[model samples]
Target chain A: MSALLEVRDLTVRLRVGGSDREVITGTTLEIAEGEAMGLVGESGSGKSMTAKAIARLLPAGAGVEGSVHFAGTDVLALSGADLRRHRAKVAVVFQDPRAHINPVRRIEDFMTESLRTLEDVPRAQARTRAADALEEVGIDDPARRLRQFPHELSGGMLQRVMIATALLSRPLLLLADECTTALDVTTQAEVMAILDDLRRDRGLSMLFITHDLELAGAVCDRTSVMYAGQVVETSAADRLHADPLHPYSAALVQARPDVTSTAERLVAIPGRPVSAFEAPSGCRFAPRCPHALDSCRSTEQVLTGLDAGRVRCERAATLRGRLLDPTESPTESEETADA
Target chain B: MPDADGPVLSVSGLRKVFGTQVAVDDMSFDLAPGRSLAIVGESGSGKTTVARMVVGLERPTAGTIVACGRDRSRPARNAGERTRRGREVQIVFQDPYSSLDPRQSGAAAVDEVLRVHHDHDAATRRRIVGELADLVGLDSRQMSALPRALSGGQRQRVAIARALATEPKVLILDESVAALDVSIQAQVLNVLADIRDERGISYVLISHDLAVVRQLTEDVLVMQRGVVVERGRTTDVLDEPQHPYTQRLRASVPGPGWKPTRTLRRPA
Candidate 1:
């Protein structure tokens, strides 16, 4: 089957205060119908920007190149009523519900506003549909909840309300950008379970964005790791930890503290993460990668297919088995060094 | 300094009530010198309340907190006493952004702490500030940069350095690494471990992440609604939890091959 959402060689540049910075460069990925794709990255990795690009939510004066296609429609080329229709087809749930939602509005007003204004549904019909959507997300006493203000609900409840409102449009692609990052673990589990059930039951597609690799691994079918505004690796989510292709991916797998076991010291990646503007000339991760060769510093690497997966590292084949080994040092890989 | 052989920090029957509601009740723990203890719980579980009570931010209605062989159960009687108490215990908060002043550079923040707590000369204060920054793996560029110019991890390092400037015997990490990314979290955790090994300082860690708790602390306490449900060695308690709440919490964490199951209701 053809992919539902396709982004090809997409590059985004932000112009703020007379300065330009490339936030995303050459990002490419596809989401099949009903497939949940995980976009995993640290801060400044541009995972959120890619979602915004697809949703047409980029800040004013931001320059966009390449193409974002959804169901054979050019998202970047959409305008006027067509853009509004396209937006209705895609919904975004942010990290914080309180910030996105209006504090003074009652739950019913907020939930039904989209349906009432955009689709011109009757107020009574919109309220009924909103109640049903709330019920579907596991909220009890939906009628009572609809009358309550935003502050009356807890964080988890507010998040559920946001999800319910997002579903009122019946969007095909859901952009969940760190939706659970601010929640408690148990609450996060509940929200995640609700989303998982909703997606599976409705056959909806999702672009799940999170910094937690383990979370993405558990929830998504395929995962794409981003670094410094580029896609570094793409593979089946379950295989990411066991068999990571890029050195950066391997380092990320090793950097986390394991709950089941204890290591003498966590294998922390040296140097802090950089934004795309500050990324080096060649490979973005070479500054911190332990297995980085001299060639990696000067030669630009491109994403290539390997073992039914894709990676952006040229030395992926040579460094295959040793990537996860904690004791593998930078100098230890000198056998492959040209100098 | 107090007796080196005894616990660096001790609490007994800690209780706090806001009007009619009891936020924390009958909570007690001790931090042995050169050791770390974690208080793990979900939101409103009173873990943060326990930290606040220990740090003198909240006055306990009942129970006593003894730090460095002195009763700190009540707020300090004078400014001098408060400064002295600060030297005994310090805390690092969750958000690095708000905890730091936007206008002050990292080195200035550390220097300000040193000036308030100690009688060091200008040269000595500068030297100590540089030493503290280096101890947290912050370079000179980060040291001179303001909080906004630095990353979240860099800001947190500056916060850690400021906390260490007081040379406190016990440090309370109140969800210190929760706001950071995974890579940066690992870096900060390593810095904390190195500090513990080098200075032999005790730690009272308040957190909800089990993986972080397991990595940093030796002992763990599982709390629910201000009550201690389970407490034991970190590995043993996490590996084989006896309390239903603790079991549910462990099951909630997502890991390799882990799946989130819907509970019957939201736990009270």
Candidate 2:
């Protein structure tokens, strides 16, 4: 029962001359084999930074303080010859479809390169492999798609290609970072199914990073609520949705609008995610947290209780409101409370 | 709710074509004064194009744009009646990052329109700018900040403040809240709702997110590939969608607790 990927105390920093901007601090989470972990956060909440750190794909100036261990190997400690092979074990699916793919390159060309770059397969065989990989991602006509450019395909089709490329690598872990946000809802659901099937069939481990709490609630086995770069709440998937421990987590749940029920007003988590470059004192969410006490301003809470999802705030346990479970039909009490 | 009295704007057989592709086809709707009409559709559904046509940024290939009972002079081909329409109607776009000029401060962005539309003195313009900012919930202190300097929510408020500066009768928003998170979106929407209630300004909101549309608007219009296939009361349309396209669109949107049901096709 060993985890496929174990990230420990990971920190990412952008160094310019002497000054360094701490982008992500104290993010530690793991994805067990065939298990899914939902990494939930707002934009610039360091979810993306934590994802990038896993592959050691940091930009040149990015300095890391912690280890990203994938399958017992400290990926961060590996150098040149070892690190190159280590890099192929983990792949990332970025947020933007526009920037992720090369606009000029054919979808097949990119897919083939992902496979051939690691093992030096014959050009002819790679083409067939690429077509198979494309088909695996729900693209019916892979042969025709090989000739088309990125712009030629719709955003949904392009995102499928992105998943296809990640599958070709046959990585142990996939970092799907807001991959479905840009897609239309029907198409977004289709893409999510593909990922779900891939995880089940391929035994893939995923760190699904997104701002959408609803998507996380539906898919992940476990969820880590990261606010301003720290893991505030870690709970079993059902438990997290049923009863979110953190105040931010509660606010996120309360903020989510129920599609089935009609609402007069959707309560939004007030204020914005703090900018990573300018870290805040006290709780990063304290400025916006409705339950903030005098202690929150002076004390920073470290994540407690690994068994059940834990939060850092002194009032984390005291703030015990439950999140409405999506699985069960809304009860009268739940509806009345939310209403 | 249809009134016995006439609507503020009535559109019938509104069709706009770019070559053979129909951007807007046979669109018909009526908006009463102070009422909000939300047009929800995915990208390329012609929501933006429809908004552009409504604001006189683009002339329709055919149909009548009866505004306040008179057909607007077919959007003068060269001049682009965006400014003339500014006195009565104004458009707010999706990205506040790109919607407002990067260099212009929030105060200047709002006042620039006033300076162009009305030959007002500096003090009058400044006072008007402050009033506009206050209406949209921006404090006087935030007046000097540029678009880049402000957060997405603040910048959107700045955009709304600028749009309100002209004292427009109608506000046509093209996915204006799409760029913001739920919280920030709520904040901006409050400002918009306040505007409609206070000034009796008509709103034509074009968005892909149905929840926002359903929550804010009394009426809803569903568009697919530039043609509106369904139109009704927001709750009615959402509760029991008539058209398949509307059903599918409604299903796709993540509502109060909808988690996209495994990306939404029921695994077909």
Candidate closest to the true structure, highest DockQ: 1
Model 2, span B44-161: residue lDDT tens: 8888887887778788888877666557638644443545556677888999898888898999888888977778999999888877887888887777887777898899899888
Residue ranges of candidate 2 with Cα displaced over 4 Å = A16-18, A322-339, B1-4, B77-83, B119-123, B254-268
lDDT of 2 by residue, A4-61 (tens): 8988888888886789888888778878998989999877788888887887788887
The 0-to-1 C-alpha lDDT of every candidate, in the order given, reads: 0.91, 0.79
> TM-score, each model?
0.97, 0.91
Interface RMSDs of the predictions, in order, are: 2.7, 4.1
Q: Alpha carbon lDDT of residue B74, candidate 2?
A: 83
Tens digits of lDDT, candidate 1, A178-248: 99998989889989998898898888899999999999999999999999999999999988878898888
